[model samples]
Each structure stands twice: as structure tokens, then as C-alpha cells.
Target: MKTTSSLSRILILVSALLMVSAYFTPLWQISLWAPQYPEGLNMKIWIDRLSGDVDIINGVNHYIGMKHIGQEMFPELQYLVYVFGAIIAFGVLAAILAKRWALYTYLLLLLILGLGVLVDMYLWGYDYGHNLDPSAAIKVPGMAYQPPLIGYKELLNFLAYSGPDTGGWILGASVLLAGLASFREFRAK
Candidate 1:
């Protein structure tokens, strides 16, 4: 029979690969698919495409300051970082806690994470423009999108603390994998 440690090692490798794959996706872009809730796409890539426009930065600033414009899409860049942090944390913590209790906890975390994101996205998907007459443009329908927490010091504080300690869990998982593998060698007995 395959040993517990051997299986754990393999699982750890698989988890790492899955996270890396998610990292390269255009989670930053909004599309017909992920533009709104339940199942939605990222919107940041869509903004990146317009980064070359001479007016984009000025436009983004206006929106962050609460100006009513489709340009509200910019500050949402914060979510890209948020989701990345979530994925890394869940992947490492759940992967390391691959034991019975840890397994359930990990699954619960996944379900909660997915639902949280879906709900958040759904609210964001509301589009007043879609239903309005041609001449009347409208703001989106959901929670008024707000400027992300701002200022240099505040931003740095979030990146360091609010971003989640995934790095710690990632290292912990790696060390556990190596230690477990070494302690319970996978060679044929």
C-alpha cells in the first residue's frame, strides 16, 4: 500500500502546481462570463488593455475620488491581490492540514471562499446601463463601488498585514512535506 507520507508529498506537489496555474490567468479581466456573480471572470485585465490610453490614469484617479464614471473599474485592482492572497493561503493551509480534520476544514474554507467571491461578484455585476434608454447612461446597480483603502502608508499596511499570511503557511507546508517525506521514507519496505 502507498504510505500516508508518500501520498501527502504527492498531494503537496499537486497543490503547488494548481496555485501557480491560477496565478497566470487573466483574473484581472472582466468578460461576458465572469463579469457578474455565481460564475464570473476577472476585470483587471480589461483595464490593463486601456493602460496605454493617455487619459486612463487621470480617468482612474477621478473614479477613485468618487466621480461617477465607468472608470470605477480601476481601483478594483485591489481584488486581484486579494484573491491571490486567498488562493495561496487556502492552498498551503489546506494542503498541509491534509489529515482528516484538516481535510474538512480545508474543504469548508474552499466552499466559503468560493461563495464569498461569488456573492461579492454578483453584487458588483449590476449594470444600470443595460436597462436604461440609449440616451441615459447609468451607474451600476450594486453597492456603490468605492475607492480601495488608499494612501502609501495605509496601502503598505494592508499588503503586509491584511493580505493574509500565506507566505507563512506556504513555507510551513513545504517544510512539513520535506520533513514528513524524510521521516517516513517512501521506499519499498
Candidate 2:
């Protein structure tokens, strides 16, 4: 009979709870630093909203003609919370089923979700960076201000860094925990 160890089930449940907690934390953050603004500007992206120095960031972006970084710009915000809720539910069901197949399916879903998020972020960055207005105040002959997806980049005089926030770290740990559970179940089989 196909089965999952009790420990594996516990791990899956724990991961699910951790993901739920991520709903209350910032999932991603983008920061910008320049000589004029020694303090740096930060924008934190939550599951359903944005926080931190958004207004300031928008004001700065205005000079370069980048689209305003606002909640209205991201339709995903309207339904992303529901998507995560469903993923968490899948995890809970996987734990309750206590079957190797269920755990593997949950792991697969997590992988897909992670990849999809990265692709989406990259696309958004591309559009924002490439779609500059002809009437912008600052225009480099062939420069695009696309920020790094997961690291540091220099754009003009500013240093931009993009990476996961507290919630992202928790979610990453949760994914790893789930992976461990999957590996254990695979070994048991």
C-alpha cells in the first residue's frame, strides 16, 4: 500500500500553516539607493497590497516616465490571495490524505507556483523598463531601467535591489520543508 509516514504528514501541515502566515507579511521588496537619497527608498509588496515608500518611488519614477507603481497596476493583487489560499488548502489535503502521491503533487504545485511568480515578475519589469515615454526628462540613448529580479543592478545613478522579504523567506523555508517531506516519502516507497 502507498503510504506517507506520520512525520511527513506533520511537516506538510506545518508548511501549510507557515504559508498561511505569509499572508500577513511582505512577500517581496524592492529598494533603491542614490547619492541624493542616502536613506534609500523601499517598496514592500504584500499578498494584496503594497506598503513602504511607494508614493516616493512613484514620484521618482515619474521623472523617468515609468508607469506609476500602484495597486491598480497589478490586477493580480485582486486574486492572488485566493490563489494562495487554494495552494494552502491543497497542502492541508495532501497532509490529510497521507499518501505519497498527494505529497508529490503538493511539491509539484509549489514548484510551478514559484516558477510562475518569477516569470511574472520578469515580464512586469520588462514592460516597465522598456515602455518609456518619449517625453521623459531623462533619456539615455539605449538604456532601460529594469531592476534585477533577485539581486543588485545599477540604473543611471541609482542602485536598485530586488529580493524576497520576510514572507518570502518563510515561504521558501516552507517549500524546503515540504521538499524534505516529499523526499522522505519517496524513500519510504
Candidate 3:
């Protein structure tokens, strides 16, 4: 009987633990700056909710015709916790099994899930920015307020910066650990 290396199993288990952090930390953040507010404003996105100056941000978004953001507005928030739980479960199972194939499959699924998250966020941003209400207080014929998917962008006078936050960093580290484990496994074969 062939057995997987101890290091691979340990790494997979560690990855599972790191994924749990996603539940409590904000996964992404957007910061806004304009001449009026030199201190800047921030919005945090989590799996199941939004935080950090959301009311202020929503007030600002109203002028640009973006829909008011609330937890009820995002259906994904209701289901994403389960998805993260499943990923964590899978990682734990792979670690316990200590099988080479199991580890590889788990890593691949995790990677695909991560990419899906990015795409979903982009789609949400696109809709929020492009789908403006016709009767908004302020109207600029062709202006859109789409926040950057993963970087900085200028949305009129506001400079917006979007990137991964605490949970995101943990997710990234989990992915990195899985990758390193895969690399080691492949080399051993």
C-alpha cells in the first residue's frame, strides 16, 4: 500500500484551519478618496455581510444611482457560508485520507472555487456600476461608478482602491500551502 507523505497531510490540515478564518474577517475592501474627504472612506465585503462605513458609502452611492447595499440584497451571502464549510470539510477529509490523488483533487477544487469567487465579485461590481437608476439625483450621460475588481481606478473625483482584506489574505495563504504541497507530492512521484 502506498502512503502519502506526512508533510502533505499536515499542510492540507493547516489549510483547512486557515479557511475557517474567512468566517470572521472581511474578504475584500474598497477605499474611496475625494477632495472633500481627505481621510477617505472604506467598505468591507465579507462572505455574509458588509461592514466598515457602509451607511456612509451607501449615502454616497445614492448620488450616482447605485442601489442601496444591504445584506438582503445579496443572495449569495446566504449560501456562501455553506460553500466555505464544504471546502474546509474537503480539505480535512483529504488530509485524513493521506492519499496523493485526494490531495491533488482537493487543491484543484479549491483553486477553481477561488477563481469563481473573483468572477462573481466582478459581475456584482459590473451590475452595480453599470445599472444606474434613470431618476437619480445626479446624472452624467456616460459615467459609471464601477469599483476596480482588484486594483485602483478613478471613478470621477473619487479615487477607488479595491483589494483583498484579512480573510482574503488567509484564503491566499491556504491556496499557497496547497500549491506547495502539490509541488512536493509531484516531485516525490
* TM-score, candidate number 3: 0.95
Instruction: Quote each prediction's TM-score.
Output: 0.40, 0.97, 0.95
- CA deviation > 4 Å runs, candidate 2: none
* Cα RMSD, each candidate: 13.9, 0.9, 1.3
Q: Name the Cα RMSD for model 2.
A: 0.9
On the 0 to 100 scale, the lDDT of residue 139 in model 2 is 83
Task: Pull out the clashing pairs in model 1.
Answer: 28-43, 28-44, 28-45, 29-42, 29-43, 29-45, 30-42, 30-43, 34-40, 34-41
lDDT of candidates 1 onward, in order: 0.38, 0.91, 0.91
lDDT (tens digit, per residue) of candidate 3 on 1-189 = 345699999999999889999999999999999998789999888989988988998999898799998888779889999999998999999999998888898899889989998898899899999999999999999898888999999998999999999999999999999999888998998
After superposition, candidate 1 runs with Cα above 4 Å error: 1-9, 28-76, 79-83, 127-189
In candidate 2, clashing pairs total 0
> Pick by lDDT: which candidate is best?
2
Candidate 1 structure quality by residue, lDDT tens digits, 1-189: 223354654664454444443334332222112112224222233212222222442333243233333445445554545655565576566555544344334445444654564455444433321222333233334423322211111111111011112332343354454345434443423
Better model by lDDT: candidate 1 vs candidate 2: 2
lDDT at 54, model 1: 23
Mark the 10 consecutive residues where model 3 has the least summed lDDT.
1-10
Q: Which ten residues in a row have the lowest lDDT in candidate 2?
A: 15-24
